[model samples]
Target: MMRRRLLYWITALGLGTLILASTGYAQTLSQQVLNLLARTNTWTADQTFDNLTITGVCTGCGGAGGGTVTSVAMTVAPAAIFDIGGTPIVGAGTLALSLDTQANNLAFMGPNGGGPSVPA
Candidate 1:
């Protein structure tokens, strides 16, 4: 009986470790934007991404430029929802985004009428 209990405990511990190890963590929207900016200052061609949500304050999501001009243009297809600072901005279709770091500005051009300009 003692040997059987020890074996059961070992098996349980091994399974638990395996399950935890198999789990994966995904990066947040803000983190993804920052990573892209780190790679390049400007995005020449228009980029597209899946539905994303921005939670906390997103600093530097507007690209990065000290004194020079920097910009990024991308499209969020299907649907794009932004929940930041408790404010929710929801949109459908293709959501076009233009970011100018020098001006600390972010513009959104969605389907139908044009979108709003958000300060970064």
Candidate 2:
């Protein structure tokens, strides 16, 4: 009886760890948007959000200053979102904004190909 109980406890503990490793705490949509904005070589971060939708301007992406950001947003995650003055480089034929908070950095590929921006 004792051996059986010990085995059950061990199995339960392992299962719990598996679940945590798989599904971490949820990320707000706004935060994800801000991350996309900061990566641009041109645009400066006007605002940040948790949702996928973003609104920003581009005045110093790479040029002296000529871009304007009246508003920025997308119905869904766009292929890419560059800074106010940044150029949107297409990766893997498209752009995809993804986020992973697994303590390890997430790969924010333009579409779908590459490793994490940071090792985390």
Candidate 3:
């Protein structure tokens, strides 16, 4: 009974909020958050990536179109070090990314340490 009441209240609140949305209001925050990939900015630099670990969802064949079944997987890897020209690009940075692919603003990049020495 309590669960039903809570659901009822939630539904009602959602409906009320939707109805009360003013015409003057623009895009919703939830819509923007869902559009992260759409909003990603493309970045390109002489990025020497090391100690890199990328995190993102991967979809496999399944669901309505039947195929091999499997669970969600999490992958990890160790960091590395390398050089780009005279500038030693060490640690993970956004060099692999192209400014066209990533649609986000090119914000400030943190200093990952660059010297003549590239750590082994």
TM-score per model over all chains: 0.12, 0.12, 0.13
Q: Go through the candidates in order and give each one's C-alpha lDDT.
A: 0.31, 0.32, 0.27
Worst 10 residues of 3 by lDDT: 7-16
lDDT of each residue in 22-84, candidate 2, tens digit only? 233323334433345345434332333332222333222345568645443333333243222
Clashing pairs in 1: none
Better of 1 and 2 by TM-score: 1
Residue 90's lDDT within candidate 2 is 31
Per TM-score, what order, best first?
3, 1, 2
Higher-lDDT candidate among 1 and 3?
1
Give the runs in model 1 whose Cα sits over 4 Å from its true position: 1-23, 29-38, 43-120
lDDT of 3 at 98: 18
Q: Quick one: ranking by lDDT, best first?
A: 2, 1, 3
Model 2 has an lDDT value of 0.32
Estimate, for each residue in 39-105, the C-alpha lDDT of model 3 and write its tens digit. 4343222212232111221122135765653333222232122222222234433333112333357
- Residue by residue across 26-116, what tens digits does model 1's lDDT show? 2323433433633544422222223222222222233655673243334343323431231132332333344323323645566777567
Model 1 poorest ten-residue lDDT run: 7-16
- Model 3 lDDT, residue 35, Cα: 34
Weakest 10 consecutive residues of candidate 2 by summed lDDT: 7-16
